[model samples]
Each structure stands twice: as C-alpha cells, then as structure tokens.
Target chain A: MALNVLICDDSLLARNQLKKSLPADFDATIVTASNGLEALTVLQTQDIGLVFLDLTMPELDGVGVLEAIKAQALDCLVIVVSADIQPQMQQRVMELGALAFIQKPASADKLAAVLHKYGLI
Target chain B: MTALHFTEEQRDCLQELVNVAMGQASDKLARYLATMVHLQVPAIKLVDTQQLPQHFAQRYQQQSVSLISMGFFGDQGLRGEAIMLYQLANVDVLARLLEYSDDDSSEAEMLTDISSVLTTTFLNGLAEQLDNSFSYAAPRILSSRDQHFADKLAATAQQWQLALQVDIRYQLTDYSFHCDMILLIPGEAVLRLRQMLDQILASF
Candidate 1:
C-alpha cells in the first residue's frame, strides 16, 4: 500500500494547499478530516502514517487532537500547519511530538525540505 | 473622566498615529505578500459599543462584510488593550498579492492556506511592534474566518468597552476593501495604551 497521509483542518483551503504541495513523485494516499474530532474518527479506522494538522478549528482544536493521538498511542507523525506561528506555540507543539511545523501558505519547496528532513519524502 | 473622548486635535493626532502604524503594517504585509498595497483612511469614528453596528453598516454601504478580529492584552492581563479588524478583501488581496497557491488543490484549500498565512503574518507583525514598544506581545488571533459584520460587531461588544474606531480602505488593481478596527480595553488598560502611545511619541 502507498503511504497513507491524514490531513486534518477546519479550513477546506488548507487541506487543498497541502495536497497540492505534495511531491508529485511521492506515492502517498491522502485522506482528509474536517476538524480534530473528525480526524480522530478517521484515524481510528485508517492506517495513517503522517498527519498535516491545523492548530485552530471549531471543534477539538489541533492541540487537543495531538493530545488525543498521543493518548491513543497511535504511531503517526504529526506536522503542524498553522497561521499562529508564535515561537512559543511552535515550541509547545514541538514538545508535543510533532516532527515539524510549517507556517501557512508554505511553498512546495519549503514543504519538500521539511519532509526530506523528516525522512518522510 | 471614565469615558475618554478625543478632541478634534487629539483625533487628528490619533488618526495620524493610526495611519503611520497602518502604513508600517501594510509595508510589512507587502513584504510578506510580495505585492504592493495602498491604504486609505476614509474616516475615524469615536463611538460607544451601541453605535458600532450602524457605523459598520454605513461604512460598508450596508453590505455584509467578512470580518477578522483579534485582541491584545498587555502587562495587566485580560484588560484587552488593543484589537485589530481586517476586512476579508484586504486579507484576500494580500494573499493573492503574496502569490499564495498550491500546485494541485481545490480552490478552497488555497484560500484557507492563504488565510492562515495572512493571519499569521499580520498578527505577528502587529504583535512584534506592540511588544517592542509597549511590552505587549503580539496579540494572539483567537480565530479567523469570513464572519458576518453584524455577528462580528455583536461578539466584540460582549468582550470590550469600545475604546476607539478606525475606518480604513485597502485597494490594489481592481479590488477594494474596507476595515474597521475597534480598539477595546478595560478602563485601566486603556490608560496603559495611552501611556504607551505617549512614550512611543516621545521616542519619535
């Protein structure tokens, strides 16, 4: 099976951008969840390897979802995509076990570098 | 003098102050967006919470506008001393100007991603300035979206005693957008903001 990726965000726009930014040569199947709650549900059934999560959402924000993922002991890598790019928030997310943090509207090249650094690409 | 009012002279000074601050904000945003943006000061209104909606309606020509609101609390805590409001158009154009896009995605994500970037950039810049000058960390954007004008103003009314009102217009090419930033704070916080402003003025 190709690498399964889960994208969780409240904004439809963010999901689209991450999908578009994926490296074309990478063989990965992308799945999306509208919010952290939905992401938790989808994650329970899917063998997701990576997650591109957003911090702010209507229900069960990103930080909450990260906690849930941790509580469930799911072996998934998290990479946060947020508009709240405060250094403090970044540090907090990193401490929570996210492999990386990508500010919003990240370019494909920038993302590719992040993925490569994580050995995910 | 619980309810402070700006005299005509003070109003002009405040207007110029906001203009300079906004000019710097736009310049920072332009750098982030990689495009030029022009801002126009249509009018500045000093109103209480009750008069906010009517002012917003008249400004946007009775059209429901998409609004983004954020609050900043400095030194003394929850007495939010400053806040920001950006029209959706200003945000959208800024995103476009920044060339925000993904190679293969639906239009929706493109917009969301751009929205995220715009929020981050605008908040970060404003926060840095406030923090540097007033020891106020950049305000945290609690949330951002295409919200109705009435809903936005109503929600703001609950949180603050409206301190001041700034009406601004942003334009580029064929697109035009308007914004109303209503500064809100507790009585004490308002005093701090004024003091901060005085110090900033003195330094310059």
Candidate 2:
C-alpha cells in the first residue's frame, strides 16, 4: 500500500523542487496545491497521509491552514516548509503541532528523514 | 556652518556596515531560495538630492525600480534611514533565484512578501549585534519622483542638508539577477552609528 502525500505552496517552483527531492522509491501519490485554501479542498476529497506546506502564502497562511486541519480533526501529519527561519519562527511552528519545521528548499535527505520518522516513506 | 556631512569615505564605512548586515541577510535569502546567495562588494558614493533624477535616469535606464521605505528610531530620535530599494525583476529572475518555476503569480504580487522576510531577519540580527532596540513598521512601496522623493526625505532631515547614503547590490546565483539596498542615515545618526560600531569593536 502506498502512502498519499500533499505538497501545498503558492510557488510552482516549490512544487517542482519538492518533486525532485522526494524519495523516488517511496510508493506514494504526491498531490500539489497552490495555497492553504486549495490544500483544504484537496483534503476534503483525498486520503492524504502527510503535508509539506509553505508559511507565507496568500488566501491563508500556513498557520491558518494548520488550524483548519486541526478544527476538522484531519488525521494527517503536517510539516511547515518556509524561508522564515528565525529562532522564534521555528518555535511558533512547533507550538502549532507541526511534526517538523523544514526550512524552504529542504534537501532530499531532510525530506526523507521527516517522512521516515513518521513511517510515511 | 551647517552640520558636517558624510563624504565618499564615510559612505564607504557605512557600506562596510551594510555588507555585514547583508551577508547575514543572504543566509536567510538562501534558505528561502533554497540556494546559496552572495552579495558583491558595493561601489559607494555620495550624491546630492538634486542629482537623484539624473542619476536614476542615467544609471538605471532600462530597469524599473521598486522602493520599500521604513521609519527607524532608537538611541536617536525618529529617523527614516532604512530602505530596501531594488529593481523589480521578472518572474523568471525571481524563479531561478528562488529555485522556483514560472507558475506562481502570487509570489510576485508584493515585494514585502519575498523581501520583507529577509529585511526582518537582517534587522533582527543587526539589533542583536548592536545591542540596541531596532523595530520598524512593515515597509511600503514608493515612487522615484524628484520633488516627492526629496520632500519626503527632506522632512526626515529637517535640520540637516545632507545625509549619509549607503548602497549595496545583491547578486542571485543559479540565475543572473541583482537588487539594490540603500540605507539613508541622518547626520546625527551617522555619528551615533560610528560610535556604536566602535563600541562593538572594543568589546571584541
């Protein structure tokens, strides 16, 4: 059985970057969303196992999306992928129940590690 | 006699200060771009306010400039010294530099969205280094009109005729793109800044 994962961000470059970095052998269907609002739309319709999200986005930021996910009690792992890597920013994402705070343009190794830790790889 | 103003040499000193600030800023930009970012050594200059129109037209003839201005105050009175002004590059430039593709229009909607994070990270770092309180409201966009630009800046430096301006350029790799960062420190603040740097050096 393959895991289903979602990649949500406002940048097409980010989606392309995620595709190139994800583990090739990992059997999962990776879905992409443009922002938080679309991520939620996809969630309502798909069986997603995990999410890699960007923080500063329009139509809803990463924090807001995290809240929506929690509000609906969705059983999916959430990881924040952002460029804002200040120490305080890391704490804020962690406090929001994000499984991990992976900085933007995360390396393949980092992505693999996060997925493996959650048994989603 | 009017208050003493910053010469090219004094501007160079400030450029060094800017280099230190931007070097730290590049680290944050690299994380966002998902690639290494390097800033080149800047060419420092001291231009009168009257020369700005000719300077803008002659030097940046083909580029559309974008300005982000903010008010700074601490250890000195209210002074509008920090501004991140850059040429708004194409999406392709932003894409390659950021390691993103041409599909995200939202990414280009506001300079504040992309550059503001870098500014905040740099300012916060500078504050830590200077051991001073540094905070500014969100940066706002502005035009480069001679009269309007001069008027706004003149209001900030009511007592002083000349101000110290530091200009630095940021080069984005994995793509051929660059942006400018200009800091306009008031005459009073310039002396204070030099003193602050000396104090920091003494500590080391």
lDDT of every predicted structure (CA atoms): 0.60, 0.63
lDDT of 1 at A49: 94
* Model 1: per-residue Cα lDDT over B78-153, one tens digit each: 3443444455445555446546553323323444443344434433444444453223344344234444666556
DockQ of 1: 0.01
Docking class of 2: incorrect
| Residue B130 accuracy (lDDT) in model 1 | 43
- Using lDDT as the measure, which candidate wins? 2
The window of 10 residues in a row where model 1 chain A has the poorest summed lDDT is A81-90
Task: Show where candidate 1 strays beyond 4 Å.
Answer: A1-121, B7-12, B41-45, B76-148, B173-175, B197-204
lDDT of 1 by residue, A18-57 (tens): 7887888768999999888999988888899999987756
Clashing pairs in 1: A13-B108, A13-B109, B33-B98, B127-B138
**How does chain A of candidate 1 score by TM-score against the true chain A?**
0.96
Worst 10 residues of 2 chain B by lDDT: B144-153
Stretches off by above 4 angstroms in model 2 are A1-121, B1-15, B43-47, B89-92, B95-108, B144-163, B201-204
